[model samples]
Target: MGIIQSLKRFFSKQTETSEKNHDQALQSHYYKMTKDKTFRELENFFSEKEGFEIRSVSEEHGEMIVKRTKGKPAFIVVTIIMVRPFRTSVDFSVASETMLFTDFGSSRRLIYGLYEELNQRLTFVGTGLGDELAK
Candidate 1:
């Protein structure tokens, strides 16, 4: 029983670490049919979110940087890639406000929240979601 419990703990921590370090763009349904539309929708979501301060938006590059003002403050990079003329891919990356490894899970949860709102705001193109985002 002790061994089993230890294994469970180890697996749980490993899962958390894996989730804490992965790219979520490849399998999220947040992809839109158009870059402009996708950007506009994300703009609205990020702008209105409490504690979210959008720093920059590069339409040409289809990317935006948002600073979270809540806790220790972190920078969120939102990137949109146009797969095709009508197929857009949106991805997010969160950086520490300081060069510290303190992003144990808050940043991730924030991303999850963003995706949830995005999924709701944008027309659900498909029901699939990245593992982390699915939670």
Candidate 2:
């Protein structure tokens, strides 16, 4: 190829490589967030409960998997997934027919309890709660 063509190809390849590297870096950052010590503690706490199971766990995607059982359903189903960004200034969610936030663990408990109650009610009726309930 000519000189100009060769230069263009070289620059194009460099741009592609840079974009791939950036994407990889972002993925790694997300993974670190998911595997954070505090987050893991929460995951373990939920996973060890008698009536619940973890469906999936991922820091990169900011999602926590949970499964719950309901009497009317006659079968267990995945429910109550949690998601929160790692670098956000505050944590908040709209689930269980309400919105909640926390700067301290105390508030977190209240929100979680409320969510559980809502989940129980909805699940009892054999109606699935939408993502809004768990956000």
Candidate 3:
């Protein structure tokens, strides 16, 4: 009985360690994705293209907030959020002051393409996220 209990405890410890490692990997991946210079440039490019000035960008939290002035009495604020998990895939969302947009395929593709372009310009150090946006 004691031997069986010891085995159970060992397995439980191993499972916990595995989970922790997976979490760390996810965090590292997220950090790499956010810290990529290409990604940063793309974010700025998008903000400018949309005529919104970026207010702040939180790479650790994977959030970007931008503000735009749309004439008198109308103001638009946009937020870009990313969710990445090691065990799963990366996800992205875009929201405006008034509405939540769920269509990500096109947006993701655009981002990925921009990253690719930057990578080419920079000699392709790799984004560590190949084809992730395509999926």
Candidate 4:
């Protein structure tokens, strides 16, 4: 592959991998997978690790929204959805802070890395979340 093609493939990772079927299935599979701490943990994760400030969370709905508090970050729009008990599906959408037409997978790397950490810590979900979730 050419350098540009490789960069596009790596950087501008598609959005389809964000919400997965397995993630959907996980929700209905359990009534209380690991208690309702998933969203809370997510709130904490984004804040403590990514330095994202929590904007809002609906505990009843099991969802949260977080974003960068400082200058414009590489990515924006973080949505965490608890599809089912103990199953949380996350989607991170990026709008480059600069004028670049494409990113070198910075967004994908950020989200997937954090997702893997979350899967590891959460322990309810399996690994990688899926390479599909990344480049």
Candidate 5:
């Protein structure tokens, strides 16, 4: 990582996973699982982790809002969308609640960590598929 990139990351309070993210770790990840199953797994995973609390869930929209109340507080939004049968994409938006200018990449780290966990539990698929799988 270049110094400019590092500085930008350090000063940024939020990070979101997307299909074309320059940072590979921040790219949207695809999994071979049903949306419902993925949602359940995510809820259970967060519930099992200490200091993390699920604030709300919208099954209709396939979205979950989570809050980290313990050390280094953060707000997280998890989105799961099914592009095809048994092909789902998971994206994360995380924002660190720090009192200073930046969170020092805490949000990025949190998203990366969450993706790592999901990758371990779910069937792996390629990242940043976008519409390539549709056509």
Candidate 6:
């Protein structure tokens, strides 16, 4: 919102999707489903992508680490957790590999793109429902 904050974000090399994030597009997305289905779908989703690579997958922890090898390299960690039955939460952490400190919002854009693609394959409920949904 402010000039300093804008500059900091612009110069940052990483961005993560969280519920409390000020940017709506960067907020964690909620889905009405289970972790198993989400995990499988995500594995397929990234594996099918041209520039992305599934580096590691841990269904036990509901986490996946992926790397983007082409065009502006970046390492992405996708966390998928089922808060409760039929209510799952997905969050993303992206770190860009570049000469400068900034990725010019590329990390944020990548997360947004992932969310968009997953929204199409899964049942999206809402974003930032950790407090209210858990109860």
Q: Which candidate is the best by lDDT?
A: 5
> What lDDT would each prediction earn against the true structure?
0.64, 0.33, 0.36, 0.51, 0.91, 0.89
Clashing pairs in 2: 34-59, 95-133
TM-score of each: 0.68, 0.31, 0.30, 0.57, 0.92, 0.94
Tens digit of per-residue lDDT, candidate 1, span 32-88: 568899889889887888888999999998889888898758777788866556656
Give the per-residue lDDT digits (tens) of candidate 3, residues 91-131. Answer: 22322232323222333333344334444443332223434
Clashes of each: 1, 2, 0, 2, 0, 0
Error of 3 at 70 (Å): 4.5
Residue-level lDDT of model 2, residues 33-132, one tens digit each, is 2225435654665566555566666676545645443211111111222235432111223112112331223322333453344334332212222232
Ranking by lDDT: 5, 6, 1, 4, 3, 2
Query: Where in model 3 is the C-alpha error above 4 Å?
Result: 1-34, 68-91, 98-135
For candidate 6, lDDT tens digit of each residue in 1-135? 789879988999999989888888887898988889888888999999999999999999999999999988999999999988988899999999999968999988888888998888899998888768757
Off by over 4 Å in 4: 1-16, 19-35, 69-72, 82-85, 127-135
Task: List pairs with backbone clashes in candidate 4.
Answer: 11-105, 27-84
Candidate with better TM-score, 3 vs 6:
6
Q: What TM-score does model 1 achieve against the real structure?
A: 0.68
Q: Which stretches of candidate 2 lie over 4 Å from their true place?
A: 1-35, 70-135
Mind sharing the TM-score for model 3? 0.30
Instruction: lDDT winner between 1 and 5, please give it.
Output: 5
Write candidate 4's Cα lDDT for 88-132 as tens digits. Answer: 555555554546655555555555555567666665454225443
Ranked candidates, highest TM-score first: 6, 5, 1, 4, 2, 3
Q: Model 5: per-residue lDDT, tens digit, 1-135? A: 789987888789999999988898898899999999999999999999999999999999999999999879999999999999999999999988988998877888888888898899899798999868868
Clashes of 6: 0
